[model samples]
Target: MACISSDSSDLYDVLAGRPRLTGLALAPSDDRLIASVQVINGEGNAFVPGLWEVDPAGEWEARRVTRSLQGEYAPAFAPDGRLMFLSSRENTDPFTRTSSDSTGPGLWSLPEYGEAERIVHHPSGISAFTVAHGAGTVAYTASVLPGAADTAAHAEFREKRESAKITAVLYDSGPTRFGGADLGPAEPHTFVLRPDGTQADVGGQGVVGGGDLALSPDGTLVAYTRAVAGSDPDVNANVVVVADAATGEVRRIFSRPGHHYHRLVFTADGRSLVSQRQRELTYDTPWRVTLVAFDPASGAETDLLPDFDNWPWPGSPVVSPVPGDATVWFTGDERGHCPVFRRGPDGTVTRLTSSGAYSSLCVALDGTTLFALRSTIDSPPDVVRLDAAAPDQQPVTLWAPADPGPLPGTLTEVHTTADDGFPLRAWPVLPRDASAERPAPLVVLPHGGPQMSWSGWTFGFGPWPFAARGYAVLLPDPALSTGYGQRMQERGLGQYGGRPYRDIMMLADATQTRDDIDATRTGLAGHSYGGYIANRAATLTDRFKAIVTYGGQWNLESFQAETDLHAHARRIFGDPLTQRQRYETDSPHLDVRKAMTPMLVVHGGKDYRVPVGQALGLFNDLQRHEVPVKFLYFPDESHSVGAPNHVRILYETVLNFLDHHVLGQEWHRPQLL
Candidate 1:
């Protein structure tokens, strides 16, 4: 059961047709492969996610895992070959629904090709589970704080408070109880289940937050990250702690301030633990990676891959089990694109793949095979397997169903110049069917996270929907993007609407010079920080024919005051009262009346990070100026537009709006005005 996009010439169609399937798991005894698949019909609606099992010979078939749960994620095979996954059941009690207090998440298990049974239930949240090799024991993180029953009420109150300053006494009402009593407190705690279904707390008493728990091959020791609440959340008081499985005796082996240790793994010998520390530095600080190995017995720590000059941003470390060969594998940026690397015991590094395709690597049991999702900027994600021992490992597509057809465009990556001559990266997808004689409409997509950058993926945001309607899409990764070093990220700290806006304008100008683009028919769109940029871009230029923003910030001052972590906001932007000029200059509201582009605003009603007020501020400003605009609010969403139905509606609305403004199509009837 493979999923493929249905729209002809759709960017998703080209990428989804690339044959990448995800959620691959292999059984230890027989080495059979099991994977979870998303099935799509000809109408482009994703049917439910299903579980599939493939024989060693590569023969496979699939069965639906949950009929009731609409969104099922993170499926894995239990040691006994049974399927275990997470799903949220719908709540219908009117009072519960209105009060924002409902509990429905549960850990469910089903026999291989059998019905699903609820194994664990929680009203709060449960995530990141690791099952022992034989399936006799399972370890997972469960939040046991009060107010788990009412997520809506909790969210509403949390939003209203401006700070996450809840009374300390209410922390004990967690959603799940193990061994007859609640874990107590809403903070995340690690728990383990024995063969008989009985559960016990694995972390020592008083351990507040735990993450990335890894069990030893023999199931005797557990390694996890322990985070203690500090006076400030931005300044994390965290350390890597290893605990004994039987006695629950804990020992702290490593500590780092303002740096997070994650992706814990035990070496084959089981004597040492390896972990990756991601260190974030401010504009005035230096960035470093301290990869350390800790001895469980003496509590001594050794630097294996210390702060090297040329280092990759490490993610999800895995260790091989073969004796005399202690190797660690992780994903990092080796040469611009994310790739998998194997660090031998001697500290030598080996690059495994070279297609420059974006890959998320996950290792199998014997360390002989690697499963990954490989994709390019113009390609949809596909699942591929790499033979670790093969001299020339070619990626074989595990799933490539029938395609909707080839896209009408060619996607190309181009290097452009920023305001200060810093090199910027942008991907431009031009219509293959377009000619120099005719001009094609263009859409400038600003990626979310002014801090994050657009990477090696082909389909971005609502670009596919517009591309299917025959518009060229341009995605830019300006100064404040990740993959580039720390300095590049901090460059836009106080220049949100300043240099960043200039860089985007330059990219737009560069795109207009292309033979296949229509300079007259240009539009802008983005979400989060991208939303902020898009709104500001509209005010800065009448060159854009249409503008759309999802969860964008309108007033930086209001955002800083309303957002969580007031302390960090003060640290990042300085006191708004003191830096009033900087805040006003960076905010889109200061120039809202200057906006000339026809605009559409979309927001999740429940978003906390940017909040709905941000969108309302922009919408009200547009209305005050008698500007042509429409606003669509999703009642059941957050910072991200999660629901499939809502996303579909958003895509349709964006396409119609772009068509009217940029393609000379019939104007979309305004919904809000």
Candidate 2:
């Protein structure tokens, strides 16, 4: 809760220098919290995630536990109190890990107070794993070649393919790539690792894997979310499968026609599990996710807070660690506030955190103490303690590794009436010197998700760099963004660029009323879905002096057909072929001639979600129209441009672009370019 001086390093350096707290886990026996801290290595190309421990009660200072150059993630404690996590550090288990060094992630553990050891190694590596709450048994997912019986067979095939100099993957259907990563020749399957370090296949031979996984209290069962491919290869639904650990017997226990069930966790009774659900098969419409419970054996079902919509998280709901309390704690973004809400045994949901955004939640074994990485619009993530029994108490900060000096600027929220007769809200971050005489140039930033909202601010979102440079950044959450409740999000279903832009413009109009804001020199910027609006801003309105689009889609027709987000495209834009007129009208690439504003297009070449082609099309059209434009492309990046050097350059380039196009300052090229 304390800020330091920016004596040696400016706010941008502090913002870019902060290590990311990727995940957190609590030791079942004590209040020891292990956080996965990731930072770009010296090369600024690889992320190195290591384990760091903090005592929430402030019994000891935060300390690093593991130092893996390749990165360690998903920190969890074994029932015996040892810290277990997945790591890609150079594996010494030559028999299982064929790679000589720095191979894929394998299961590793550190004793309660001892050195790190390789507990489970697989040639294909592990994607996700969970240790039982009451036993040392661990369940995980690893990729395997299509017909391969297990990891051994998959390894054999891999060896044969390498020896034969063959490298080709034939995919029948489904997404072969994600954000900026590849899903290749092999498919993910489940496996279980015992305390003795022995491993075996889960669900026998046919079980294919998906994303997140959870285990039962006694370690007798494993619940995982798997994509059940349907008749159309591109059409798939998430089905939660519950499997017996001892016999490899698995059953498709939980699924719905229009819903996707994932992030499965078994309740204390072990008969039922709680997980998140997506209402539809679209891009972010699914993010309006709700909580669902099911009795795997009886097919009985329950949907928690059936009326409450807005999937506050991208994945997983934290159920109370108590043995018998039917309580689940989840966060939701409402208006400008993102708070943690607790669901009690009677299904009554109550807001816990009075304000600030909460993420990476961990509950103590006794269920009385709660720990999470909390943040506000101006402050970075810090360890905070929350009371499980008190719903209205303010979260108390416990630890912050990067606690430096005071923030160079301040952040505040405001709301206005939208043209739709509803409240529209935004967070306007202004520098310390912002005033009427030297009003800050406003940058209107629309959040992604289309379902996502700017409930709280983080430096990671590229705002601090601008704010430190004296620009006022306005992050607005239109009706479509999640956290605003289900009704608001549902209203944005078919109108991707329509109502959202109106909401953004209406908010911009409100900012004009502030004497400390230069509304005339205002710029428009967004990433992902927000990028889509930025592109639209170029074609639809000259209200913005300049526009910046980061990995935004341009051609909805092709976006619907070629992108991995076919479901999102199909849902938001409908069938491109049948709705040809709608596609033509909505696709900004088709109306590039209307654009008069100078623009900056940033994209990740490896971004599979919103491919670089989207940016390329927009950039090409602007070039043809003789519109002042610039493009910053990172081939090694994904939907989000990560990596330290890349991030530094991103901040520099964006600030420079605003200077050149909006502030009438000379543009200077970044050195990295």
Q: In order, what lDDT does every prediction score?
A: 0.65, 0.76
To one decimal, what is the Cα RMSD in angstroms of model 2 from the true structure? 2.7
lDDT of 2 by residue, 1-673 (tens): 2463322125655665667776789988766788888776777565677888988787678998888567788888888888888887886555654442327788888886767788877776787888888878898887778778767677888888888998887867666665566667887777888767677787522223455777788888888777664333234455677888866787546666656666778886676788887766353453356788877778778888786654434336788777778898877776666788888989888888778878888888788888888877776678888898697788877778776457767888778987778777888888788999999899988888676778665545556667777788888888677666666766665667778888888888888789999888889888888899999888899888788898898988878776775665677676765666658767888888898899999998888888788888888889999999999989888888777677777777887888798889888887668
* lDDT tens per residue, model 1, 1-673: 2432334334444444333345566565535555556654344544455555554434464333455535555666666777677666554434434333335455677685556666765445565666655334667776543343333443454444435664333342222222112334455667776668777666631234444776665667767777554344347636777776655567554765566677777776677788877665432343445566777888887766654333335556667756456777766543236666677788876667665453546567677877666665555555567765443246766643334345556777667777787777677877665668876788998888665555555333645566667788887777565556545645666676887778778888888888888888888988888898888887888888889898888888888776643444555566777767667777778887788788999888777677789889899899999989899888767787744445566776887888887777997654532
TM-score of each: 0.81, 0.94
Candidate 2 stretches greater than 4 Å from native: 1-10, 93-102, 204-209, 230-236, 281-287, 309-315
Candidate 1 at residue 356, lDDT? Answer: 49
Top candidate, metric lDDT: 2
Q: Itemize residue pairs with steric clashes in candidate 2.
A: 3-405, 4-404, 4-405, 4-406, 5-405, 283-568, 333-483, 451-482
Candidate 2 TM-score over all chains jointly:
0.94
